[model samples]
Target chain A: MKFVDIITTAIANSFRSKLRTGLTVIAIFIGAFTLTITSGIGTGVTSYINSQVSAIGAADVLTVSKAGDATATADDGPAPYDPDKATAISLGNGSRPGSTIQALTDADLGTIEATSGIVGVDPAVQVTPDYIEYDDSGKFELTVNAAATLTTADLAAGEQLDNESTTDQILLPTTYLDTLGFSTPESAIGETVTIGIADFAGTQQQVPATVVGVQNETILGAGAGLNQPLTDRLHAVELSGTPAGAPQSYATATARFDLDASDAEITAIKADLADQGYAAQTVADQIGSFETVINVIIGVLNAFAVIALIAAGFGIINTLLMSVQERTREIGLMKAMGMNGGRVYALFSTEAVFIGFLGSALGALVAVGVGSLVSNILATTVFENLPGLQVVQFAPSSIAIIIGVVMLIAFLAGTLPARAAARQNPIDALRYE
Target chain B: MTVPVLSAQNIGKSYGSGANRFDALKGVSVDIRAGESIAIVGKSGSGKSTLMHLLALLDDPDSGALLVEGTDAKKLKGKEVNRLRNQDFGFVFQQFFLTANASVLDNVVLPLKIAGVGPKERRARGMKALEQLELADKAKNKAMNLSGGQKQRAVIARALVNNPKVIFADEPTGNLDTTTGAVVEDILFSLNRDKGITLIIVTHDIDLAARCDRQIFIRDGLEDVTRSPEAIEKPAGAHA
Candidate 1:
């Protein structure tokens, strides 16, 4: 018979019992729906991670830290202190026990900068601000973390940190505005605040600074940026407070590499740093860990979808087998009318593919609709801090792959029944009551 | 002088295997010439239907050959046999065997569709066949909605829709009432006479068998062709 005729007949035969076929289609629908949603979730989160990586920092800049020599990895554990090895320097609240380390000195900084592919290196200057006050709202002590080369920040109000200025400009966190007695974030920007620290001989000293911006604190970036000259001024005051002959070192250094450097070149640079007893990592490398975690989660979700689909495949086989049994005489009639075995097989297989198409198309459409709604709600409410993020996103190629895989499964499932119909004996079938 | 449209030579067929086996036909032979109207009459289980099936190439005999339009049907592959069935022969059954859920027109259009006839031409030819069978007005009705005679006519239309060289009817009027059976017989005879197409029928009705141009009787897996063409086994109504 003609292909079109076979297809029409298959479709007609499939729906002969509407309820049975509809139920089978629904079984397939559940599988397709689950698969589409899970795939969309994978796409959305991976896309979110990509965006976050871009916003995190410049691609070529690597964070450089001195290599430790077999120190205790435990956070609360203690080990024998080696004055010779580099350690993380933690200066804490007064009278509180804090760890000090052999920081990267001028010599070590020069070594990192002189490494091949290293364009420049800047040592992170530690700042220990004693107190801050706005006009006579009593002085409150505060601590500071060294700023990353953060050019752009998600701001509540005001411009970004003035990295271009040598003058002492600061960006204060939202929590600080309340402590400094500022009425609003907008009002605090461009306002001058005084930072008081002890000068050389345990004497009270004060430095006036302009607040250039006010920003919401983020987990990745917990502190404020200080211009080069302000960093120097703070260090100068800190040095003056200490007695002469005190050793000076740094906690970490930031190194900028060639913008167009190849992966091998970057690897070579990292190797050189390692040889010099230092470690370096680029932004992509840092994000790689995060990607691995996300991928594991998506993988698990997709596995569930696969299991659901396999279960649905059994539904197809059952439905087609029942159809073949019910239509035994009709099958014989068609064969007697001259439908070849191949044509008989095609008819039944086409019915299966049609069922798959119904389920997959319905599932995909419903997924896109529902996934978009869920993503919007999440972006607005739960993931507000990470803006421009969709919690569920669909990719066309992934959608196509899902449909193709399901159809292939359906085809396999239909094989036994289609073969049964194809291999039916015409005389016996006609005689079948 | 008319050529034989189809012939069977020592055809043999059976069901089951070994001790449980039962032979339906054994060395049965028959010839159906073009434009001839005939009947193979026998009691139930007498292998009349088996002989017709072999003649139509619906089933192959284990030990004998079948020829259609002078082509050795035994030599044809399965695909070629199917093609031969669609293009050269048609069938009607005692049960009518109309798809209960399908419309009359769709039923009539089936063989043509299997023949791979295009939709327009298939429909036109199917309608023409239905009109010839006096079923045009009922074409849109479902097969189950029709009376026994109407259903048989729809089946006949289907058999003729492809304009086959030979039409095989296995008890075509067996289910209808006396008047309806007579009407179906009239249509079958006129089609054979006017269209010059070959007709081979299998039936237990001696009266119906007497109406054909030639009569045949099969007994115990073999055909008994009497010299006289007036009766199948004995003259009609002689036993009655």
Candidate 2:
């Protein structure tokens, strides 16, 4: 018989016992649905993390701090503090309480910039702006970060803060737009605003800067971003009355290295810096723990999906074996009519594969439909703060792979019953009551 | 004068072994020519069905040669045997063995499908076979809805679809009423006479055996050679 005919006939026969076939299909559907949903969640989360990592800073930039003493441990009693190294700083996300690295100073920044493979070093200067105000609008408290100069903003409107511009520029957060008397992000672009800050003498000083852009809220948190020129003005105003003999200290420093450097090259740079009592971490290092947690969660979910699929595989075997038993006389008749053993085997195997196709196709369609709906609802309610996260996203290639894998499992399970049917004695089967 | 269409030479077949060994057919030989209607008559367990299976190439003989045309049946490959059966032999069983869920037309076209005939061609041939059996109007009906007589006729339609050189009927009329049985018997004989298609019937009914051109009486796994020639020479339609 023709191969096409065998497949078409097998597909028709699968629906002969509607209840039995539908139950088996539902079993497979459970596995496929879980697999597709978990896979989408994994894709959605990892892609969002990746975008956040890129937003933090350029890949080549490394956060550098003073390394702890070689022999110091948490169990050790507090030691006498030296004046030059008493300052402390905290690394964000996944850091333990009381985990602080000694702060860097101007002398340390110069040393890092002069080191081999180090191109640029920008000190992490702290700036506190009391409030910002537009024409006739009341002042609103605003948080400004000088580190924003080393980072890129996820913009909602206008361009990114221009680090190279000699003129003072600021990237405003979307939350402050309405309070600043701007109706929209686009309307605030290129408009000037006054930032009030108290100097060391307790006198308030007002600095005027033009808005460069407006940025959307991200998972990392959103704040006003000050470019190098605007940050220098704020720093100068905040330290006007401080003593001249006091040493300048910083929370941390951003150092740039070769963009195309190999892992070994970067590691070697870290080792050199360690010898000079400094420590360095890349963006991936700061975000690596988060990725690990997400991966572990996804792996556990996938394990459950695999278990469900294996159980469904046994369901396919049971269903086909029963079908073979019920159709013994029909099998004998076909064999007697010149259908060969191989064709008989093909017919049953095709039936099993058809069942897999039905369940997986239905499951994937419903998953994409429901998953998108859930993501949409969550985006506006629970995940409202995260603007660009889809929460669940489907990749076409992964969906295809899931379907192919389920079909393969069905084929393996079918081999036993198909072989039994193929090897049946025509005379005996014909005599079967 | 012409070569016999099927020849069996000292064929033997047995079932079981050791304590339960039973020889279904010890030594049976017969020759059937093209266009001849022959019956092998016996009681149940007399090996008439076993001998028919050997001649039909469905089972292998333990000893001696069974030949189709001129080639020994044992010499043909498995696929060749299947092809020969598909193209050259048709079967009608007392059980009717139709897929009840399938339409009557689908049941009738089974042999043509196994032969890999195109859909349009098989449909036309299948419909023609049904028309010949006077079942053209029931082609769309489910096989389960057919009466015993109509079911037997549908089986005949399936048998005729492939236009085989021979038709094997094993108790074809055993499940039908007397009137319908007569009608089925007439159709088998007329096909042998008009189309020159050979007929091999296995039946225990004496009246049906007498309708054939010749009868081979099998008793105790062997042919009864002592049967009188006059019994074998009885004319068709001589019995009710």
Candidate 3:
């Protein structure tokens, strides 16, 4: 028989027993549905982590901090250091490292810059920008949330703050336009705004800077950009007038290396720096643990989904065997009419594949719909504290892979029954009651 | 004489071995000519149906040579055998083996489809054969919906759809009443007479045997023609 005719006949015969085939399809649906959702969770979380890590800085830049004598747990935020008393520094994420880390002396700075492969070094000083005003507006408290030099940020208006420019320039976030009485990001361009922060002696100090651009923030993280001039101004005011804290030191140190350096050379430089009692990390190193944790969770979830798919494969075997038994006489009649054994085998196998397709396509489509809806709701509720976090994500390639896997399982399940149908003796089948 | 359309010589087959052993056909042989209507009448378990199956190439004999249109059928390849069964032979069984779920048109189209005929031509030939059997109008009806005579006619249409050279009916009317059986027999005989198609019937009914041009009898797995002196005088070694 022609392949087309075999396919048509197989399709016609699948409906010969609808209820049994439907039950088998349902089993596969449960498996595919669970698999798609679990993969979505993996995609969504890891994608969010990627955005967070990117927000930290470019690949060639590392945050360096002083390593301390005392061992610190992984959760230790940052080591507190006092210049007057001796203290060891184990600087980590967002921290600068050294023992009793004092202000980086000119001598220390020269030594850091002289390190091989060290192209540049910028000291980071954390300062709280407490209050702000535009022109003659009333003073409104604001948070200068993680203002840093961003390598990649989508802009709403104007150009990026030039990091090489000596002018004190800050980039305004998209949300601040309405709050600061600016009708639009375009209107806020090149406008001067005053920022208030506490001086070293605990006095309210107001500093003015120009807004060079406006930035679009994502759901996970957003930040303002500050060039060297602006960051230096904030640090100077923060250190002046004898603030309550005893001495001066940097919160973190940003180091630049050749972006084209090989991974091995970069690793060597980091090891040398670590030997100097300093911890150094690229953005990926900071977030590598996050990737591991999410992947493990996704792996466990997928195990359950695989188990469901295995169960569904058994259902396929049971369904096809019953179909073969019920069609015994019909099979005999077809063979007598000159249908070959191979064609008979193909006919049954096609039925199995068709069932697999029905279940997987339906399950994947429904999973996308349901998973997206749930993730959207969580975006506003459960994940309200974290911006740009998609709890569940779906990819087209993942969907294709899921369907392919399910079909493979179904094909394997059908083999035994299809062979049995092909090998049936026509005379005996005809005589079967 | 023209070469017999089908010839089986000294055909033999056995069942289970050891104490349960039994010969189904021991040296059974027959030659059937084109357009000839013949019968192998016998009591139950007398090897009548076994010989028919061997002749139809549905089963292989333990030891024998079978020929079709003078070709040594035993030497034909598997594909060639299937092609001959699809194109040159048709069968009608006592139970009228039509798929109960399929429509009459679909049932009749089965043989031609298996022969690899295209859909349009299979349907056209299937419809024409049903019309000849006076069952064309009921083509869309289910097989189980037809009465005994109508069901037999549908089965006949299915067998004829491929325009086979020979029709083998094994107790074709066994399950029907006398009047229905007579109608079925008339259709089979007319097909042989008008189309010049060979007819081979296997039955226990002497009256049905009387309608054929010649009848062969089988007793204890061997040929016996006590009722036909002409058959007894025929040369089994004519080709050999």
Candidate 4:
């Protein structure tokens, strides 16, 4: 028979027993729906985290520090502290508690910069500012870190930090706008703010900087950011009263390599750093741990969805088997009319594929609708503090892939029954009661 | 002098294997010409149906050659055989195996559909066949809704739709009443007479067999030469 005719006939035959076909479709629907939803969740969370990480614009940068020796337990009477390793730096957020490596000094920064793959190194300068005061507001305690040269902060208003500019510049967080006596982020731009810092001898000094920008809050970035000039000015003022013998060291530092380097190349660079008694972590490595956990959860969910699909596949087999049984005489008649065995198999298999198409298309379409609705509702309620998060998101390609996979499963499930129908002896089938 | 449309030469077919094997058609041979109505008449299990199936190319013979249009069927590939059957033959069974949920027209156009005829032409040809059977008005009705006689007429329409060189009827009127059976028998003979289509009917009724131009008696899986066409004709009314 013509392929078109076989398809139409198979579609018609599938609906002959509507209840059975409908039940089978419902089973497949459950699988497709769950699969789509879980895949959407994976896409949603990953994209959100990716957006946050990209906004920080530190993809190629790696934080490097002197690798600390594995410390002794509390019962070991605390290993003798070396004065050279006085400072400890915490790797934030995803790292385990007390996962502190030793500080990076000027010598360590020079060593990192001298490494073959390292293009630049920025030592994390410790700037302790006592307070930041505006025109009329009282002084407020401040936490400040110099903005990395490579980072393009997620800004609320004004331009980025001008690291090359001679004048000191500061980028305030959005939370400081009202407290800094500015009605809006834009109004704070180009205005001067005083940062008070205490020297090592307890003498207080004030440094002035122009507010160049206001940045939005992000999970990875905390406190205000200072440009190079501002950090240099603050460091110079605080050092004026420092005791001559006081040792100086940086808590942490960032090392930059070629952005387009391959993963193996990047690993080699890290190994090189490790050989120099330093440990390095790329930005992806820092955020990747969280993503890994999320992926494991999503992978588990996907496994359940696959199990459901396998069950649905069995339902398709059962449905087609019964259909073949009920239509034995019709099959015999068709065969007698010169419809070949291949055509007979195509007829039955097309019915199965059609069923799969209906269930998956409906399931994916409904999932997109329902998932979007739930995402919108959750975004407004549960995830209100997270501005750019969508709890469930769909990619068109992923949806198409899901439907295709389900259809493949259905076609495989159908082969058993289709082969049975095709292999039937026409004369015996005609005589079938 | 014309080549017979179908010629079976000592074709043998058996069922089962080893000790349980039973010969359904043992060295049965026959030739059917175009435009002739021939009957293979026998009682149940007399191998009449087996002979029809082999002649129709629905099953392969265990031995010997079955020829269609003088070409040895054994030499043809499975696909070629299917094409030959689809294009050159039609079938009607007593069971009236119309798809119950499908329209009568759908059932009639099945052969044309199998032959990959386009929808419009298939419909036109199907309607013409149904008109010949006087079932044009019932074309849209589902097969299950048709009466017994109407169903058999629909089956006849299906057989005629393909415009085959030969029609194989397996007890075509066995399920119909005498009045309807006679109507169906008249249609089959008329097609043979007017269209020059070969007719091969398998039946047990001597009265039905007598209506054919010739009769072949099958007994014990082989042709029964003792009961000739003259004997079959003479006893046509006695069996009724």
DockQ of each: 0.73, 0.67, 0.58, 0.70
RMSD of each: 4.4, 3.2, 5.6, 2.9
Chain A TM per prediction: 0.78, 0.90, 0.82, 0.88
Judging by DockQ against the true structure, name the best candidate: 1
What pairs collide in candidate 1? none
Q: Which ten residues in a row have the lowest lDDT in candidate 2 chain A?
A: A86-95
Q: How accurate is candidate 4 locally (lDDT)?
A: 0.88
Residue A168, model 2: lDDT of: 92
Q: Supply the DockQ value of model 1.
A: 0.73
Tell me the tens digit of each residue's lDDT in model 2 across B148-221. 99999999999899999999998999999999999999999999999999999999888888789899989989
Tens digit of lDDT per residue, candidate 2, span A73-177?
A: 778877777766647776532348768677777889989998898989988777888999999579988877545775677888998888789989999888888
TM-score of chain A of 1: 0.78
Specify the CAPRI tier of model 1: medium
| Runs with alpha carbons beyond 4 Å of true place in candidate 3 | A40-57, A65-116, A135-142, A145-147, A154-159, A172-189, A213-225, A241-252, A270-279, A285-289, A372-394, B17-22, B70-74, B224-240
Candidate 4 chain A: worst 10 consecutive residues by lDDT?
A: A143-152
Using DockQ as the measure, name the better of candidate 1 and candidate 4. 1
State in Å the error of residue A395, model 4.
1.9
- Candidate 4 docking quality: incorrect, acceptable, medium or high: medium
Q: How well is each residue in B64-178 modelled by candidate 1, as lDDT tens digits?
A: 8887767788678888888878877888898877889999999999988888889999889988999999899998998999999899999989988888878899999889999
Q: State the lDDT at A359 in candidate 4.
A: 90
**Can you give the lDDT of residue A69 in candidate 2?**
76
